[model samples]
Target: MATLVAGANAALTAENPGLDHVVVGMGWDTIPSNGPQAELVPFALMCDASGEAVSNDHLVFFNQLVSADASMTFVGDGDQEQIDVQLGLVPAEVTKIIFLAYVDPEFRGQGTFASVRSAHIRVATAENRELVRFNLGTDHLDSVTAMIFGELYRHRDDWKFRALGQGYSTGLAGVAKDFGIAL
Candidate 1:
């Protein structure tokens, strides 16, 4: 599959019914800086049809590696943190699984996005055969503090992958508020 740009999306299960499971991976490279570099922590938000996170436990990251239902599991691999999703096992109330990364607030006090570049997200089969990839564009990275790399959402009985290179200049708090998370 060809690489996707910001806002572009592709059908997942619809293309291959057998593709019921996948590993979504996110990766990035940091730009050298004199000041303390920003700490980037990748996480997944399992949201309901309302677009808000179902609960605090629905937020999966390095700290909370897996969902209670055993549907989404975080797998760390070098610079990339992956989430293995069992599509068929996802809760019925969940409509989307969003992939995001934020600047760890404790690191140099609300760090800027300028510290990272060449960020990307990709989807692959459970066996690691990459299906599609999205390279986040590098425009206006200096001010942003958090970013949404991509998302996998439900469409009827199928799932779709979207490249979302959007960010929050207000820091992680902005993301928490928008998603109704208590930080």
Candidate 2:
């Protein structure tokens, strides 16, 4: 992976001195597939500092994952209960993010299910500065546990998610706290 670098305004060329643009490439491959398009399990995003969604965190999440066909992708917002295309405000200084790929609830029993093999994050500032690039790969069960725990942090505060899985919630909450993003 490339090191995170600052963005430059495209309009601000040697002659223009105004236009700016920043481009980042996030890539991944499923284990043993060696294919270009890897299937990513639905991963959650949260604030590494506060362990909660303030405002800017939402912005960053949308900016990174939002798309027209969002409903069909890993973070698909295709279902109304999930999300559609919508913009929200981002917060001031975001430090870190986490990712996880897992077997969907319906496909959990099947061995052949999509998992988040790898994740990459890139932040482009107003002038298109690439401020952050982070990647994670799941190679063992411990990593999988941590990823699930991260998701627990994301949904812990919600009343609707309260009854999803009592045992898993408790365990995941503890894991999230341990990772510095408690709920």
Candidate 3:
């Protein structure tokens, strides 16, 4: 079962005019189960309207955005860090963001199973604060562990949202398959 943290809340509009699509920024560390450090894995963005994954199969990158391996690489400590991505009307019109995450089976030995202690979704704004935040519970992400859902409205639009529009949810990756929102 999955949870809908926020319905379709408009975050932008024709008047405000947000970019039609977005490329997600992602970075993570790969650590030995018992080692004290972690390494970063590279990441890529997929703009497929059908929700097809963006892997080495479709696009390639020689440097920043692209690499030889299918997944993006992050070289550093295992701790989580934020990465930047470009957003625009390309590949396809992306109104939502999807995060595909799984517990590193090896991580259990180290105590962190690639679990997202917390997660949120927001528009690109003057301040980095999120327009909305979604929480996650065990039930929301049983196998994957957690999922988050965020609605990207046309920029500068007034959307109706509950006070706690943010709640526990399985990240967008989980919901897209069923609801077709991320697509």
- The lDDT leader among the candidates is 1
The Cα RMSD of model 2 versus the native structure comes to 12.3
* Rank by TM-score (best first): 1, 3, 2
Q: What's the true lDDT of residue 23 in model 2?
A: 28
**Two-way TM-score contest, 1 vs 2, winner:** 1
Write one digit per residue (lDDT tens) for candidate 3, span 123-166.
32223333333343323322342233333322223322221223
Candidate 1 per-residue lDDT over residues 103-138, each given as its tens digit: 887876667778787899999988887889999887
The candidates, ranked best first by lDDT, are: 1, 3, 2
Q: Which stretches of candidate 2 lie over 4 Å from their true place?
A: 1-26, 32-39, 44-50, 54-88, 91-103, 108-119, 124-132, 135-183
Off by over 4 Å in 3: 1-4, 13-15, 18-44, 57-80, 92-97, 109-117, 126-129, 138-142, 145-183
TM-score, one value per model: 0.95, 0.33, 0.42
Cα lDDT for residue 17, candidate 3? 49
Q: Best candidate per TM-score, number?
A: 1
Give one digit per residue, the lDDT tens place, for model 2 in 83-182: 2211121122323223333333232232222343444433233343543444443444222322331121112211001111111222334434444432
Worst 10 residues of 2 by lDDT: 158-167
Error of 2 at 24 (Å): 7.9
